[model samples]
Target: MSTQTSLALWAPRLLSVLRIVAALIFMAHGTQKLLGFPPGSGGGPAAMSLPWIAGVIEIVTGVLLTIGLFTRPAAFIASGTMAAAYWMAHAPRDFFPVNNGGDAAILYCFVFLYLVAAGPGPWSVDAKRR
Candidate 1:
């Protein structure tokens, strides 16, 4: 196959790889907030607090997305969470995402948004169910 065609053939599989990697990384952030694994400078959030709540969502969505189960809805929720995180926590610090440390949040939001529209690929449980 031509290079272009070869790349196109691998696209769907690459999506799965992207989802798994991103979800795992996302879960790590949640773990830091909830379990304090690898230990941050301080303890986790107070119970039911915003950070704690975000951590919960992150873990749930991360697991779902990683497994390719409930992929679209999970991605949608994750995307929204990242968006809110950027606006509430980062944007207020600075207009520039780079200055505000919102770059990763923005990237995650857009990537999750893409996954929502794209759906999980043939490697996903969602695909197998169809």
Candidate 2:
């Protein structure tokens, strides 16, 4: 195939991989919360009301993302989930990106927002059916 054609074909595949990776990452986080795995100081997986809700969202949306099912809605939900996380958990912090303060949530919100707009693209279960 022409290099351009090959690149075009590969691009969507790469994005699909990225979608799955992002989903899995968030899924693990949700599982951690659901299982009550301790996070950093003052943040354990016990039974925090807020974390429980976040965990449910993360798990549901993450699975939807992984399967590329209702990609748009799932991505939208994930975006909101991350946004709430940033505002509620990270806003009060003044640390930089790697400081484990609020940077991660802020970054995650942006990334998930982008995914919401981008959709799952080709190479996904959604694509296979259509």
Candidate 3:
């Protein structure tokens, strides 16, 4: 097959890889906040507080996105959460993302936004259901 055609054929699988990897990382962040999986960091957020609520959102959306169930909506919510996180929590620290330590947040925001547009791709529950 032509190189272009070969690349195109693998694109969907690559997308699935991206979705799975990103979602897993995102979920890890939530767990760190809510479950303190790695320990030694800090306690979970206070109940009903903003960080607590955000942790909830992150866990839920991360699972949905990871499984590619309700992928679009999940990604949309994830993207929004990251956007808010960057602006409210990170941006104030500095104008540049690196200085603010918001680089990861910004990356997550755009990556999830891309997933919303791209759908779950192949090997996803959404694809299976369809």
Candidate 4:
């Protein structure tokens, strides 16, 4: 294949990697909340009460993203979780996403949105299944 074609083919693969990485990150946060596995105090089910629901979404959606199963729904749920995180956890501060800002949530929302629109591409299990 030509250089352009090769780059084009690999582009989706790179995006898949990004999706997996982002999902894994979200999964870790969810795991921390769900199971106080690690030594330190995790985000426990009591940390933020209402918004804690996002923890469930994060865990399920992260798994979906990892396997490229139900990509759209997973990304949608992930986006919602991030949005909730922004409003409930970070919006009280500035928008810079620093110490207590909504930056991380904003970024997470965008990442999930991208995956939703892109549909997991060639490197996903969804693609393989099809």
Candidate 1, superposed: residue stretches over 4 Å from native: none
Across residues 71-128, which tens digit of lDDT does each residue of candidate 2 receive? 8888888888888887777765644545547665666677677777887878677888
- TM-score: model 4 vs. ground truth: 0.84
In order, what is each prediction's RMSD in angstroms? 0.8, 2.8, 0.9, 2.4
TM-score of 1: 0.97
lDDT of 1 by residue, 7-67 (tens): 9999999999999889889888898899997588889999999999999999999999988
The TM-scores, one per candidate, come to: 0.97, 0.81, 0.96, 0.84
Model 2: how far is 129 from its true place, Å?
Answer: 3.1
Candidate 3 residues 12-129, lDDT tens each? 9999999999999998888889999757476888999888888898899999988999999999999999999999999999999989999999999999999999999997999999
Which regions of candidate 3 fall more than 4 Å away from where they truly are? Answer: none
lDDT of each: 0.93, 0.79, 0.93, 0.82
Give me the displacement of residue 116 in model 3, in angstroms: 0.8
Measured by lDDT, the strongest candidate is 1
Q: Residue 80 of model 1: what lDDT?
A: 99
Model 2: per-residue Cα lDDT at residue 63: 93
The residue-level lDDT of candidate 4 at 70 comes to 88
Score residue 99 of candidate 4 by CA lDDT. Answer: 70
Model 3 earns a TM-score of 0.96
